[model samples]
Target chain A: MTVATSDRAPAPAAPDGASRPTPRAPRRRPRRGTVARYAVLCLMVVLLAGPLLWQLSLSLKGAGDTLYERPPRLIPTDPTLTNFTDVLDRVPVLRYVGNSALVALMAVVGNIVGATLAGYALARLRFRGRGIATGVFVAALLVPIETVIVSQFLVVRSLGLTDTLLGVVLPGAVAALNVLLMRNAFAGLPDELEEAAVIDGANAWQRFLRICVPQVTGVITVVAIFAFVGAWNDFLWPLIVLSSEESYTLTVGLNRLRGTFYDDPRLIAAGTVIALIPIITFFVLLQRFFFRGLESGGIKG
Target chain B: MSSSTDLAVRERAAAPRRPRAAGARATHRWRFVPWLMLLPGLAVVITFIVLPFGNTLRLAFTDATLLRPGRWVGLENFERLLGDDRFLTALLNSSLYVVCVVPFMMLLPLVLATLVSRPGRLMGFFRTSIYMPVVMSSVVVGLIWTSMLDRRGLVNETLATFGAIAEPVPFLTDRWLLLFSAMFVTVWMGLGYYMVIYLAALANIDGTLYDAAAMDGAGVVRTFLSVTMPGVRSTMALIGVLSSVAAFRVFGEVYVLTGGTGGVGGRNLTMTMLIQREGTGLQAQTGYAGAISLVMFVVLGALLVVQLWLQQREGRTR
Candidate 1:
């Protein structure tokens, strides 16, 4: 799966002198740069897309086609979408999608509300215990989610939220990293605006919503996309929390495609591709925002 | 302006007296504002993340098996770890992975960012194409690569056609190849992410630096070395830390690639895998897994501190 760090490439900048063919080319190129660039690009295509394409081929192939006598064809000879239909029929695919969507939505909302409020306070308010809260968060970064799984499970179960969408979403609604990112974004905004709003009889909430929130829409977009991707692609927590088959998310559901459609690799690949399509689109759409967010974050933070 | 100045003077005049009289009331009322706003997040962090971490630490110290009550074993778990060959192997494998992947991931992104930063007409397309894999989950990546590395997969088929080898290379089964394959997949997955990070840093770099360098007739490579590289030094350090952390935590690819065995003869069992295997593998030795995890946590902590120190030093030097 795509790691979070990679998805946040800096947005392309508007080039100065868009038409200038500067004389710097000869200085940089040793002939190998071109060769190396092509080589890397070719390698990138192969390495990045190879598995995805292979999965597609295998998924479409008929039974016993995995080790085809002829070298594996890129496309299936029969070219059937049967695997997709088969996966749809064999298991509770819709239910799994619903569960994943519900959990992810809740996670997004929860993270936004919790992280935004915390970020605002940390950014604007001067209060006691701020230092301690910040320290707690930074410390939380070192604590692997896996290390706390059992404890979280216990706590969720005790709270009666376990095995439900709320259970899985609530625990992860806020994270230290999100807080840090949001704080960075908020800190960059001019403080004068908030003070002006306060002077104009705007309450704290109003000023934050109208003034601070708009100023940091870029960061908010980044956070929302991150939460969505994280919740959607999440595996371990969902695996632990959602015991019922009906509560399965896409990641778990796709994994089930392996056993249910045992002989059919097409079904699995189709399932993977289907799952990946949305995620890839999401990344592309937000690529511009994600890059800007990271770039500003690095400098200001 | 006079009114504002008067108010400021009044506030300045009143500041000393108000602190003694209104300080108690103001402090009490304002103190809760930040805390109140922060409570919800704090609750989640403590309940889910923090408590769970504590549980892991506690669990590590006890002789607990799955579904069994743990007995306090103090340093025994830590003591047993000193002799854990598998732990040692996983540690070595993870180190090797970090060592190899970090430089490649770091440099490739720097290069790719440079290339795409000013990509003439194809900038958007090239950037998007490069970043396509940045959104997919690791599960999908693992599944995809497994399909490719299969015996009759594309790489081998191409090799066979070119007569590059007498036989198809067993990519997943062979130990070194398996590691390489996993590393390759990891780097591919990682490149676009860091590329974006670097791209962002590059955007912030004052274009005038390049202009200045060019005015001085400095070569592209020289400008890059003297200007761009130094300009993005802090960002590079940040990425280095992040990349190292990721490398040290290598698990998912190995788990999916070799199905948690780390390929033939446990050649690829990373510490995370070892801990996971002990916890849920056929053995299900939670205590031992917890112990392995504790060792790993220490390793991670030590490595992170050292990395931070190195970066701080580099920052100062720059």
Candidate 2:
């Protein structure tokens, strides 16, 4: 429907399917079919994002507001932050936040470093069992984590890492899919630059770190974002590994909030909203990179 | 993300063989460098995924508990599975999920992708907002729906207000309804994620095909059938495989909706839910869980193989 501006900006067939508008594309009325399309889009949005917004509205409602009125209120007439404060006071919201943040940070850094190094080596350097190494990662990719989870927990327990953040971050630290993505990114680059660097007496490490890594920073960002989101959003793994309340991530802690106080919808809404804040902010700021990296990476559909 | 993941491995499989013997970089000293660089990632993957899976297979044949590693029990656990009523319900629920969810996942996202294909601010807004649910934790998604589907909650209240129904629908308590509700949530969360993949695949579609369709006076429906369908056939098949496997192994939505008890009488339990319930915790009967996991692994593996075979067959038939 927004294709109304296609005349002015001339919508380029970007790899991401023309989502990003060309610069200075002035606003214009939608073409004929675009109107009906926009109506459908709006309805879909209401069906989709409407729930989250409703939750946000409920979170903002004050103690005076009756939650289940005959005609429900979409907006809080007297908006207040008491629900947020109430959830925070009731649970270790900050600790859970910090724990979730730490897990996300670790997963991001680990995937970027680990996936990048292995990806570069696999793509740029040839060695024994290269096919086997690639195969291993591919095989790992096929194994549903759900299937191996119990034994993974046993592995963690054996390593004395259960109930710890490290265990939660380990299995996903170097996700196989990210490694293959990085490998594909590295492989897509022309060999001329690395070949020149090699002839110039630059070692493999130098060629990789100085020449190759720079070209694939985009994929690295993609990996980081995926890892961060995966870690932040993960529920089952951390739930299985970490039993102690102190080690609980935001998702787990929020589930506790729901279990303990199912009556207080406002408080639960506030907790979920609090959990959503950092990730949404992060996504909004870096979504350009997120989609762009995805486009250039030519991620498998 | 899983839709992309299954395709990732398949693409790797089909990727052109890597050329070797590049330059001075192939020296003996550099021989170990690739291995060294690969060590950390490989170590993590092997330790956590590969080795544990091996242990799982081993444990599946044993009567291991959390405390003591018992001796081999061979087909005992598998035999127990035959009589386990919860296991049967879990299998049935998981099968129902795959049947209900996969087709919607394949078709809906492609439509969504086509709808927002053109570039503009509003389109981008739709894209980002639709994809937002994908980024959210399943727990958050589950909780949000749980609140909405409550007895006197948003859905029932709205329905009653509209004079649609007389009594509140038992979404959370009833077993069958809960499974269907979980399926709805699965499709809801998955739409934009697969829509993005469909967007990528849609972009790969040749524009000249659309032009050709138009030149022939092809209607919208005709154009879609002749142009878009063939173009994204493989992607659709890939989505079919990914969504089916994911649907079969569903855990988070059912877990959150049923509040970790797997619904009233645990009739809504999924394969993953069954594994989590039986395989984990202090009194964990890991042997039985391992048997359940082995079955899950094989079922999923068979799913992948069958889909791939079907895709290949369709290609040859075309």
Give the TM-score of candidate 2 (chain A): 0.87
lDDT over C-alpha atoms for residue B30 of model 2: 45
Global lDDT of each candidate = 0.70, 0.83
Looking at candidate 1, what is the lDDT of residue A30? 30
| DockQ, each predicted model | 0.34, 0.40
> Could you tell me how far off, in angstroms, the CA of residue A144 lies in candidate 2 after the best superposition?
0.9
- Model 1 scores a C-alpha lDDT of 0.70
Per-residue lDDT over A191-248 for candidate 1, one digit per residue giving the tens place of the 0 to 100 score: 5566556555565566678888888877777777778878987776666667678778
TM-score, chain A only, candidate 1, equals 0.85
- How many steric clashes between backbone atoms does each model show? 14, 0
Give the CAPRI rating of model 1. acceptable
Top DockQ prediction, candidate number = 2
Candidate 1: which stretches are off by over 4 Å? A1-23, A26-43, A57-72, A75-77, A157-162, A259-262, A298-301, B1-24, B27-31, B66-69, B119-121, B204-234, B260-267, B280-286, B314-318
Off by over 4 Å in 2: A1-32, A293-301, B1-30, B215-217, B310-318
